[model samples]
Target: MALDGQNVCRHHGGNAPQSLRAGERRVTEERARVLVETYGRKIETTAAEALLDEVQWTAGHVAWLRERVQEIESEAAVAATDREHPLVWGVTREKSGGEDRGTTEEAAPNVWLKLYQQERTHLVKVCSEAIRAGIEERRIKLAEQQGVLVAQAIRAILGDLDLTVEQQARVPEVVPRHLRALAS
Candidate 1:
């Protein structure tokens, strides 16, 4: 395979890419060991790193999406507020004055529903990518667990590892706390 802009021992079927620096090797080994401990079973270094990368990337994307959704909701709420125009038409105002607050409250559910749909759509996109990458059914199932709740989805993904207490304590420092909580 290619590594650092050069091909490694491709003819010899060398699995280790030639580009790994000393520090990266240490980090990779630590991550691989953590994966094995987390799953209570042996896992190849490459595969472990790949799984960790996937989980991290998915979590990051979901977090970004959630933040964006919140921003969108804020915008929506502000937009839902009734603004007065100099040229008033058939608009009616209650004797109490001010726009109808109930209209804004009624829209809150729809805003939540729209955000939920966006999250679900993003999850399906991730799942499809996993399928295309030829991930196993177990991994696919884990990927699909990503839903509206970011922490809960991460917890569900790590739950599949079934890490023992000792192993859980040995989880890699690189792993986020939300994911580590699953093992706990």
Candidate 2:
């Protein structure tokens, strides 16, 4: 592509070496600024808040996978009738070619169960990274900091939102159960 605000093509190296470096630096900076503005406008969360969000998100996902795994196992215990459960949840590759094939074998529930367990394990590992990083935020390991962080995050969220009376009531019953998953 042509260089921005310049006559030469970017890939052809027609510009002098020093000018090319300066131009590349300008482009890089401008791109970074645009990205910051766009992302900042969209979410506006600090790094700490982002990590906290990721922890909650991963914990919620792990909770869902646990329930799904139990259901799959329960189904497997009885009869082996259904077989269309996906190998990967939320994604399936399409054949992209011409006509659809009529006959195709499907994965059994045990396979899906194992996949869900693996996903939950991976998600726990992801949350552990966030937890460990939080523990190290002070340059010394503070194993109990996860609880404090969770408490602080909850306080921050509840403090910021104007919840209805019902919503406020629900927080006590709801938040602790999901937060409990992080300990596991």
Candidate 3:
């Protein structure tokens, strides 16, 4: 579940080419708006607005995660270079219970690695949940809108005739084959 650089790259669509400048590769506001509009057409305005809001929050969260990951890695690198014991082994000095201080240099690399991986896993889970919630919200909103549209369309199609309210309500349930074909 732990996310590595590969996972980050995958979620981002792919790793940016090394030669591409950050400014060159960044998505412009206009481009983002066009993309939202393109996808927005499939759903109602409420859903689109919700998606846009979720996207903004997700962007900020992702930025923070990236920064935190960088900080952790940088700290590890500095510790490895500056201390006699590498970060993989253990901390240079560890505080124990009852105000006792101890050097945990005997710790295995896997222990530190597991802690690092756990952090990444937690981040990945947070990211996944945020995205999943957004998708679910959009899906529910779109389905609700579609249901309303269908009802309105059916009412309009049956409205011109001299049918009672009861008959109009039953129109969808007993729609004629010809009418269904025409609608389709």
Best by lDDT: 2
Clashes per model (N, Cα, C within 3 A): 0, 0, 0
User: Global lDDT for candidate 2?
Assistant: 0.68
Please write out the lDDT profile of model 3 over residues 57-136, one tens digit for every residue: 55665566666556756876776754433434555467776656776565444344455566566556655765766775
Tell me the RMSD of model 3 versus the true structure: 17.9
Q: Which of 1 and 3 is ahead in lDDT?
A: 3
lDDT of each: 0.56, 0.68, 0.59
Among all windows of 10 consecutive residues in model 2, the one with the lowest summed lDDT is 84-93
TM-score of each: 0.25, 0.37, 0.26
Better of 1 and 2 by lDDT: 2
lDDT, candidate 3, equals 0.59
| Model 2 agreement with the true structure over 32-98: per-residue lDDT tens digits | 8999988765668776667767767777877887787777556655655444433323233345566
Better of 2 and 3 by TM-score: 2
Q: Which has the greatest TM-score?
A: 2
**Candidate 1 has what TM-score?**
0.25
Sort by lDDT, top down from the best: 2, 3, 1
